[model samples]
Target: MTPVVELSGVHWGPKRQADILHDLTFSVAAGEVLAICGANGAGKSSLLRLLYRHQAPRKGTVRLMGRDLWLMKAPEAARIVAAVLQEQPTDFALTTRQIVALGRLPHRKGFGPGTLDNAVVEAALRRMDLTAFADRPFGTLSGGERQRVMVARALAQEPQVIVLDEPTNHLDIRHQLELLALLRGLGLTVITTLHDLTLAADFADRVLVLHQGRIIADAPPSQALTEATIARAFNVTARVDRSGPAPRFSFQLHG
Candidate 1:
């Protein structure tokens, strides 16, 4: 089967022509969940931006499905890959429903919203359990609620691949698990950047560890979260155990 997303020797950075992602190559298969974990400045967010075409690579190429990302128009690319970026400001005074409805812009022919578009937006809001808050201003919602609304907006886009940056940032433990479970149920290609190693282990089919802008480890969480790999990339000693439904990790503080 053809992979849904593929990056070949991709290199990108904002300035100085220094490659934050150095010849990074990876492919995400359809219906698979791949979590990216790394320390600060490890270039995880930069990688996501490159994949979603928010920024073009300085070298190499990024492909969505079989099409070259650079060749695709911005609206066309948005239709194929939906993203939930970290701490994106909602300075606009839009309602939750209005915010979610904007996801259909890629499919809209003119400035007006259509019935089919509104139906998809409503459905997405309901799916994310935000139906009651549909009419409320987006700025009024709590952080976790706002995060769910953001995910709902992404869902409304009906994209084949979802790229999330720190999706669980403001979510409570229960909501965090729920959101991951929901993503797994969708069975779309998922690429998420997560700081929580234990959550990554529980939710991801595979984990990719980045260090200093290079992919240091790519394997199942059981193998990827080994003491050595965790220590090397995160600079923290972790104890991995298979006692639960999935492998879990506990960090050991070091001086």
Candidate 2:
């Protein structure tokens, strides 16, 4: 089967700065959930930007559905991939419903939103369990609530691929699990940065570990998240207990 997202020899950095990411190569199969794991400044978010077109690579190519991502027009790419980054419109006075309706912009023809667009937005709201908060002002919601609104907006785009950067950052434990569960059922190519090793193991089909902008491990969670890899990438001693149905990681500083 053809991969949905592919990156080859990709390198990126702010102009004149050393590359934030090195020659990275990987491919995510259709309907796979990929979790990017790394410490702070490990370039997880920069890698995601390549996938979603927030920034093009300084070298190599990022391909979506077998075509070069940069070759496509903005709206054309938006129709395939949706991104929920840390940036939020907290100052915007738009309601929750209005926030999600913005996802339809790539599909919208004229000015007014159409019946199909409204239906898509409504479905996205319902899917994210934001129906009750639909009419509420976006700025009034809590951090977790706002995060869900962003995900709802991404869903409203009806994207084939969804990229989220630190998606569980603001959620409480219960909501984090709930949102991850919801992602598993989306039937889309899901890529997200996750700090929680346990959650990353449980939520993703594969795990990609980055350190100093280089991919050290890219494989199934079972293989990608071993004791040595975790310790090497994170600079901490780690052990995995696999006696249970799932792999559990315990960490400690190297003495």
| Residue-level lDDT tens digits of model 1 in 190-238 | 9999999989988999999999899999998888878889888888777
Candidate 2, residues 39-110, lDDT tens digits: the string is 999999889988888899999999999999999999989999999999997656899999999999999888
lDDT of 1 at 177: 95
**Per-candidate TM vs. native?**
0.96, 0.98
TM-score of 2: 0.98
> Per-candidate RMSD vs. true structure?
1.3, 0.9
lDDT computed for candidate 2: 0.95
